[model samples]
Target: MTQKSSVRQMIGFITDVTRWSLSGGIGYQLFLCLLVVFMMLGVFAYLVQWKLGLAVTHMSDIVSWGFYIANFTFLVGVAAAAVMLILPSYIFKDKDFHHVVIIGEVVAIGALVMSMTFVFVDLGRPLQGWHIIPIIGLFNWPSSLLTWDILVLNVYLVLNLSIPAYILYCHYNQVEPDPRKYRPFVFISIFWAFGIHLITAFLYEGLPARPFWNNPLMGPRFLASAFAAGPALITVLLVIIHNTTVFKIPKQTFNKLRLIIVISAIINLIMLFSEVFKEFYFPTHHSLSAEYLYFGLDGHNSLVPWIWTAISINIIGTLLLAFNPGKNKPMLLLPACILLFVGIWIEKGIGLIVPGLVPSPLGEVVSYAPSWVEISIALGILALGMFVVTMLLKPALIIEHRFKAEKPS
Candidate 1:
């Protein structure tokens, strides 16, 4: 193609993306408006945080890490969940996942972007964020796991964006992408996905002072919960797609996802049990964190209800999903999946981070609750992520549907 033709094609691609992204129903419009409102609120709150300092939130010296890092940690896992689909669809050539693999990749992009945002927000010196740049700044790359996290996350973000952009651009132009061009990225992404979450796990486990997070099982637990929650969220999105659009996801796909959720949930629950037994039965100094998380330590039981709620939801969701009856019913399946996702969210969110900080390694029991500002900011970040997911998936579904309709019988 000549330069002029290439430019025209690029313009056309831009037009297509904008057209599809902006086109939706009244409901979609209202949803977008709502997201905009939340984004505005969050931005305003973040500005306040920026001006007044981190004190606007509920974090303290004892609980230096709060909602932001928790979200960053969980979202990194959600981002990694794309690998589950990529590996099977690409390496094993499972055609069932071929179309939806793009969906997972797009979701990864949104999650990763949100994860990066959370990290930025968590930084006390957000303006000096560039200081982490190699050579130009004082980054402890080889000596610091955080530097490894920074590298892997950004690289993973690039891979997720480029792979989909290439594939989706091919679809937009009604062409097939060359496997050799994108396949190696797929393989690298699979391992890179694992590395992102593992590095995060290491960040937590490396902190020997936080006995709650010092467990050797932390890495496996992160992966298990991630695989369960990530696919569960995708399954929920697939159901939404089926209900709203002409595109159809195979029931078999949901069934396969159901199995993944079930197995991963069981493993996660088993890990939970192992932690419980070790903490409650042996009753060591490390057990204080567990006791505080579940039953409260010294009249400070704010997280008790939250932890139990998470546990109950996980159990109910696991049983419902594992059984034949619930798996077959969309009504049951949808709610079960939601429960599983929210359950893991809570488990990993406050349930994972807060307890470790409570009764700090020095036996300081400082309770932390997210102020309205923190909550608003979190809601905003979540809305931002949803908006990204919505916009990215819109053009993808449009192109996929066009291809599907154009295919010869």
Candidate 2:
């Protein structure tokens, strides 16, 4: 593969992706239309925010980060969770998992793009984003965790994109992808995935001023919840893909993923219990944020319902998976997976991010709720992620189906 031939092949790949994505069934076309509407509305809302400023949002000096950052935090975990599939498929050489590993890469690409979009939208002055660029801006290098986050995330995104592109290109051309060519990058991605999420965790835990996020367990808890929620989402997606397309996912694949979700969810709940007990048992000044989160502080209990709802759902979801692990039980498995996905969304997003900044470190308590503008922009970003996944999956699925049909029995 010379450079010119590689570039030409890449262009051909893009053309195929566009053609397949656009030529889907009625349901797919309708879904794409719906996403476009939401994306347009988000753009209009963002333009309003850009014109008026951060005043359009509910964030104040007391709670500088709001809904956007919360979603950004959760999506980073979702993005990093792709390692669950990559590790088993590539490192362990699980044949069933190899069939769906490309799907996980597609999911990661959508999620990483969404997470970055959330960060960009949260910026009050979007133009100042250039300040984080390596040469064009200061970037602050090793001194700033934010700089580290930016570096790892972009690198991970490139790895996910390139690895899949090379493999799928070979499949498209009916050639075997040389392990020597792409295997090293695959190995790098496995480790890079962990680094991305841990760096994100350090972004919070390193802040001593925010005692709520400063726990040493924060990194482990992040990984635990991510593995659980990320796999849960992927499970539901694989089910949907199996039903709607020619791609056939094996029963054992779901079984293996279910086990991972159950173990990770249990660990996440145990960690949650440990943190809760540590806070309420001996009640110190450091527990003030957790107190405010669960029990309310000085008559402020905005997050009490949110936290309890998340806890109850997660507990119920975990039990459902643990007790009912049958291979073909989509009725039980689907609901449990959906529950875990939604519960962890709440747990990792609002439940985690808001309280860390609520008390303002000076004992001043403030409340935060997303404005309509924020809601619209967040929905738009989510819609964009779905669009990306749908587009990428169309071509990838076609390639997978073709290769599977060609394989010798």
- Among all candidates shown, the one with the greatest TM-score: 1
lDDT of 2 by residue, 346-388 (tens): 9899888989997887789877779999999999999999999
lDDT by residue (119-213, candidate 1, tens digit) is: 88889997798799998888997888899899999999999999989888887887878999999988999999999999989988888888899
Show where candidate 2 strays beyond 4 Å. 1-11, 325-327
Highest-scoring model, lDDT: 2
Give lDDT per model, in order.
Answer: 0.90, 0.91
How far residue 378's Cα lies from its native spot in candidate 2, in Å, is 0.6
List the pairs of residues colliding in candidate 2. Answer: none
- Runs in model 1 with CA error above 4 Å? none
Least lDDT summed over 10 consecutive residues: which range in candidate 2?
323-332
